[model samples]
Target: PRLLKAIEQRMEQAQLRYEISGQPARVFSEFLYSTLKTWSRPRRVIAKAEHIGKANPRFVVTSLPQFDVDWKDDVTVLDAKHLYEKVYCARGEMENRIKEQQLDLFADRTSTHWLKSNQLRLWLASMGYVLLNEVRRIGLKGTKLAGAYCGTIREKLLKIGARISISASRSRYRPRIRGRSCSVWSGSGSEFLKHRPISLTPLI
Candidate 1:
């Protein structure tokens, strides 16, 4: 009941401020509170009070000592906003990396009955993901696929289906590509893998 009342009052104030300034208003505050049954020991609770189109109040309970101090000035609000944005929102990026591994590299394929085989499969998948990630980070620098996921790189480069015909004098690697015509990279067979043109025009 106390928390609800506090949130409602903050929303009312935020709404008034929004109407006056014609912009969204927010309030950041922290207080020490305790549960009636579970955690009687009081803990610090941070609240983000805001009114965009409606009431939008967010709360986070933390054990950080920096937030323990009373926040009354602009410097304290800045610090709290930075801490909340950095410490809490960074989990989203971490989750993105995990999703990339699972979806792109098949990291969740652990249905085998044997534990050893499942472990080996997961290990190999992780290693493969790391290797490709490094290739994007180092080898594919300044390329279109540098910031691309593993699955995209595989589709664009590795999965190219080219019909090769070689003669004694020279070799020609002709790959039938979709869309309009592309500039043929005519070079020795050995130079094919060694050098990639700056253009990321798909090889099909």
Candidate 2:
């Protein structure tokens, strides 16, 4: 929903046409459920096992690659894992920066509880963003935007452009880009203006 919202906002601001297909919400929910399975206690696991007869041991790793699927020539695919890895690894110092920023966000809090939960979680999300940004930046580097996501036998990538637009009413800004003039809109800024791309390309 967040990324979808971003794309919609980007389209409105940049005067671009766009569309999204597939059931991302269902896929995302399933992925989250898979991750949560790893956190189940032994008794809870046994109960589920009894109900299902058998089950695989769960892993806590992010499953972004599992979401990859084929799309039409005009469509561009965005790899969620790639984006996550890019951002977290962008600076190689994300851990340190997280701590630094968390300190500031929680400076006035008297309890360590807030630090242990909310503040720490926000910083962790930032770390994830850093990694995602790095992946999107590096993987799509030097390639045309269409090539970044689409499979082409011709080896010709579609032209892509990124431009910033100001929203006077919202006092916000967004980055807009289209894969070819006729192609759809895409970017990290579609929903979250603060979520800026570390890099972009035409995907040749």
Candidate 3:
């Protein structure tokens, strides 16, 4: 019902734009709307009425206050266009992240015989995704793997063959590179971090 109202509004705006500009133009706006039967109170509803060859009306309901409080943080207060473009789009990007974890990182690999083993596998896969996300956020700032997916990073960076020699005092590794120098893999914001095992603490 709300969507239908937004489409109607968009149709009127499109007609007005066609009358004024002599061509179909895009119209965007936000409205404070509420359905009496569904919503308890009125909320900020964003509406985007766009027409290129056809009508494309989109709507999003947000609990964010428009002018209720002081605009201290820029993240809290946003215009109708920015809200739809950034905030709503970011929500869709989060779904992409979830898909990356499940598909790329093998989070859905749960064919084990035991339930506990499958649960552990899922937990380990999720933790691997978290750690890889942290690596991209904290470590891979300006490297080639900065925007690489978990599977891509694994295949390109982590799956390289290396020769390791262990002595009484120390261990040495000669990393293999396919027709490339070792310096390209070792330094220049491409050095792998040493992982130190730590005791797990319960989240409060």
Best by TM-score: 3
Q: How do the residues 1-204 of candidate 2 rate in per-residue lDDT, one tens digit apiece?
A: 422332343333222211132211111111233223664532111000001112212122342343345565453333433333353345546565555434533322444565467566666655654544443354344334422312231122233334555676655433343244222223322323444656877789
Model 1, 1-204: lDDT tens digits are: 677575777778888999899899987777787888999699877777888978888878888766334555333433456556777668767788888888888989999999999999889889988987866666566556668888987776556678888899988886765531122122222334665667767779
Residue range with the least summed lDDT across 10 consecutive positions in model 3: 179-188
How accurate locally is residue 28 in candidate 2, as Cα lDDT from 0 to 100? 14
lDDT of 3 at 201: 100
Instruction: Report every candidate's CA lDDT.
Output: 0.72, 0.35, 0.74
Candidate 3 lDDT over 1-204, as tens digits, reads 656675686767876786677776756677778786988888888887766556767788887656434566434557787778878889899999989999988888999899999999889999999888877765565667678788876776678889999999999997677632344345424434554457899998
- Number of backbone-clashing residue pairs for each candidate, in the order shown: 0, 27, 0
The Cα RMSD of model 3 versus the native structure comes to 7.9
Candidate 1, residue 162: the lDDT equals 85
Q: How displaced is residue 153 in candidate 1, in Å?
A: 3.1
